[model samples]
Target chain A: MREIAAVFLSTVRMNFRDRRSLIFMILFPIVLTLILGTALSSVSGSSDTAEKLDSRAALINQDHGAMAGRMEKFFRSPEIRKIVHTKTYRSLSTAKADLKKQKLDAIIVINKGFTQAVENGSSKKLDFITSGDMESSLIKNITQSYLQRINAYRAAAAFAPQPAAPLLADHALSINGKIPRSSDYYAVTMLIMIILYASAYGLNVVREMNLSPIGYRIRSLPVRQINYLIGKTLGQLATVFLQIIVLVTFFKFIYHANFGSNLPFIFLVCFLLGFIIILLSIALALLFSYKMADTILDLAIPVATFLAGGYVKLSILDTNPIAVALNSWLPNAVAQNLVFQNIYGGTGQTAAGGVLKLTLIALAILLLTIAALRRNNHADLSK
Target chain B: MIIEVNDLIKRYKDFLAIDHLNLTIGDGELFGLLGPNGAGKTTLVNAILGLTAVDHGTINVFGEALSTSERAIKKQIGLVPQDIAVYPELTAQENVTLFGKLFGLRGEALRKGVADALEFTGLTDIRNKKPSQFSGGMKRRLNIACAIVHKPRLIIMDEPTVGIDPQSRNYILESVKKLNDMHCTVIYISHYMEEVASICTRIAIVDKGRIIAKGTQEELGRLIEDDQVVSVGVTAPDYSIIEKLKRLPAVKDATVDGHTIRIVLSERKLNAVLDTFLEEDLTITKIETNTPTLEDVFLTLTGRALREGAQ
Candidate 1:
């Protein structure tokens, strides 16, 4: 136990001493919280009193094909205009400038060969540009849903001369009743994103215990492999714990973000996310080289955040069961949704279930990490 | 013997790293292992530390079979890796204490062990300073300090003085000698021929995954020759004296190069050779003999300079 404590303390001290990376992790999120909290304040409000803000979007139609004409008609159509106010632009650059300047929330561009590509079915990419995610998410979703319907209707029109106009799908992706005060909402979300970045923590700490030159020195000592693992994992957890506390305190007091009364539960959820990140890092470290593992997690974190609706209101195919399950089950999304649900007026059933799911996921990652370590025990980790 | 390896064979795919290698190291012997790059030195070290699994052989450290329960076996072993693996974030004392605790030194024992290590490495005064503030040689001393805090029976030093100043290099070499004097077996690996030649009691030259030569410095020097030449420089090279020296028993040949008379003998008979020159009433201004050094032995056996590995 003493040996384990020594290992654990060294890891924690090493991490704390790395002032550069730690300061970045703690301060970057606080900065983002200030910017995002103020920008999305009205749109992301308390679940009950949170009212949707008016959304604005621009459409640029450069295609001379028949399908391009229908796409322009869909944007100008009265149904999409009810939820999202749409403007028509003759030039793509003008629409892009308007979006970048914040005059528009989003801009959807349809390239020149829209009808020809739709007919031949080679490749079609709808470019969605947004200044900020909160208001733009609504416009992006509507445009995408319209595109999905266009493809279905275009095929149907080929088989049987269909109606004269395209129609909006019967279903719409809604944000549901989970919008909390934007400052508090971003405070929680931005914190979760930074904690998920803990995925690299294990790579840094584990490298010292092995893989680095230090590993050869330490591994030759009297300590057992298991002691090194326990000490390192605990130390990483302790370091991450310190980082989350500082950020959470800053969000709650300095930034005036909301945590409701469930600060303990909020911390619990964030802790699980941090644990999973460390475990995932260890798993990757055991399986791959340090550079490879670091890169994989570096690329993976943002993608996970995007899918979790962290950057914007994720309303893509939300009506479908698969989409709903995937969005609600992502580690970041689940943690974020639970905090919002707890702060707003919601039963404990959803939060309870989400906690269970996250706990299971963390456990699974822990098991996997141990397995990888054990499998690679006989192999040399030195350079 | 404190350590034994019999016919150890380790292969990575088609590359045989340790090819049926056999070796034994006795207690209190300061063993020097010399090898070129990719000569299986690391593999052998890893095998002894129980870090690698051998294909067909056995390694017994402290008279016990090497196995995964190496916790006990590993406790008696210390390693000073080639690189300065000390944690730069830690103070000199903390680095020593942490490693001591890891090696199972308790409160007071741990404290004393740390103090001893720091003092021995001359780091007592700057024990509070972090390694980041240290010079290259200071860092190298701290590296040894970390390894010795636990006082293991067997310590393996792999190029511990590779890039340090002369003072630190001498200090490190001194520490190795002290460790051996205390009856601790040391396996010293270095590319520096002079360093190995000056310290190691018994040296082994490994090449291509096998021990090509192993013995005292003199024994290895003798490996390439059965006889030695004696070169005597005199003011005058008279034919009578040269002819008389060549006729002496056990003298293979006596030849003249400028003012030097070169004599070949099947064995060392320095007195007889000198007596012949002294009896001739000749003024011997200079006398010279060629003795093989560790560098020559390594170059002769491996056909490559040992420092080639360092480059």
Candidate 2:
């Protein structure tokens, strides 16, 4: 442990001394966030000027059930009223006609048997009719996400092991109608981009520790190889956390971006994401030679950025059967959504889901790294 | 014995790196492993350091077998590799301190050890300077300092002076002698014969992954004791004269350069070989007959110059 600590301190000191690369790692993300956010906001002008949706929406309550009435009440509440101007219409045909005539951006139809579907622990589909504009899709996603949470809780209750003990309570998050602004989304995406670049930094740290003569010197000492590797990893993690602290604080105070009321949770997600990035970097370094590992890290950042919606608001697997098959599970995408949902007050489950996903990735990468390191250790022994 | 290797063998893929090697170094001996490039000098050092596993052998260091007591054994040994192994980003002090810590030194002891190592290497005034800014000689000294900061019972230096100015090389050689005086066993590896001859108490000439000869300078020189080397400096030498000298019954080998012909013959045949050079009508400006040195011993054993790569 002492040897590990020594190596850790030494590696951290070296990283701090390398002022040029350190500056690049810390400054690049914040600058890109500002530039991208400003450019996106300008391109996507306000509703009045862009001829986009005006938040005027209509609702048709076909199921005269209690659940349907509750849904109607939610749409009419002042909380949702901030984002949506909704009017309950008697006829679905009239609401559809109004939506077509541009009087309403979208029409929400509470499907028949919606109340029974909720009470009987069955699924209910909410029909979201729209002209497929960005605002309409945003509203649909928000409403659908809320309903999905309710369904999840119901399913948990139904699957409870005992009669008296229930798994979850009937809970609905108060719709603040405060979606993440362009700055907030951009902040989170930029954060992902920055963290993904941690892989590059990680590769460099590992390369220095493994490929360089310094590594041979260390190996010749009493220090174990495992301790050396662990120390280097901790050093890289420290730098990443430092970058995160700077970027997060900058976004919070300077841009006034909302990361929910839970700052610790935001940090938790960031730390997990950082772990994933560092592990990936180490794993790649161990698996490939120096030049090949460098090539992979250089190529991975931009590709991961694009897939995680850093360049545009489109996921790599936006809509396809493979989306479900693959979980559209890019590490950066999971990281971006983890922050995006928390900032916008989406489902709380997203936090747990993100933790689970990142933890699994971390575990997998760690195992591969361990295997590679062991291979290297054995090979060295044979030398 | 500080280190003992019995019939050690190390193969890289299909090539033998350490072929059935056996060696024993007594305590406080400044042993030298002399070899040219690609002569498996580093490989032998790696085996002794336990950096490489042997195919078949038993290595006992500090009276304990390496296979079971690697860390404990490693704690008793220090390695100064041929390459400059100090971290370029770290100051001389930090580099020494880091290695010192790896050897389980801490607190006041580590501080004192690092300071002592820096002072010993004559780097006290520039301990805070990074090795990247250091001259080649200073870097070499810093490399030695890092290895000795832990103060192990035995220190192994591999080619510590491959490329450096004469001043630094002299300083390093003096430091090695100083280390031996301090009762630390030193294994100095190098290809330079004169450097080893000057300092090493015992020398081992390695080639093609095997020790070809091992002894003191006087002891190894005796390998060619029965033969005499006659160096003749001639003007406008002809290749036909060398061939004629080889035809002499007592001449073992004859080779000529632009104006000099070196002949190895039976000690009794020196007068006869000299007469043949005169018969070839060679203008002998200089004639010197001397006993064989380590280089001649190497050539007699391997039929190649000591400075040429075995590969």
Name the candidate that leads on TM-score.
Answer: 2
Q: What is the lDDT of residue B167 in candidate 1?
A: 89
Give the per-residue lDDT digits (tens) of candidate 1, residues B52-109. Answer: 7678899999899868458888888888888888888889999999889888898799
lDDT of 2 by residue, A1-383 (tens): 88778888887788778887677766787788777767656654641211232467788888999978877887777666766678888888998888788887777888888888788765466676776554564555456655755565676777844222111121122122445566676777788788887786678766766777777777787778888888888887887887788888888898776666777777877888888888887777778876787788788778777655576653123333454233336777676767666666554334686779878888888898889888778866443
Report, in order, each candidate's fnat: 0.75, 0.79
Q: Candidate 2, clashing residue pairs?
A: A383-B52
What lDDT tens digits, residue by residue, belong to model 1 across residues A338-378?
77666753322366788998999999999998888887676
Per-residue error (Å), model 2, residue B177: 0.8
Model-by-model DockQ, in order? 0.42, 0.51
Q: TM-score for all predictions?
A: 0.74, 0.82
lDDT of 2 by residue, B1-311 (tens): 99898998989999888888889999999999988888888988778777887789888998888778889988888888888998888999999998899999989999999999999999999999999889999999999999998788999998899799999999999999999999999999988888999999999999888899998888898877898888889888888877788778887777776678877776556777778777877788998887877767776777667777864
Worst 10 residues of 2 chain A by lDDT: A165-174
Which 10 residues in a row give candidate 1 chain A its minimum summed lDDT? Answer: A166-175
TM-score (C-alpha, index-matched) for candidate 1:
0.74
- Of candidate 2 chain B, the 10-residue stretch with the lowest lDDT total is B265-274
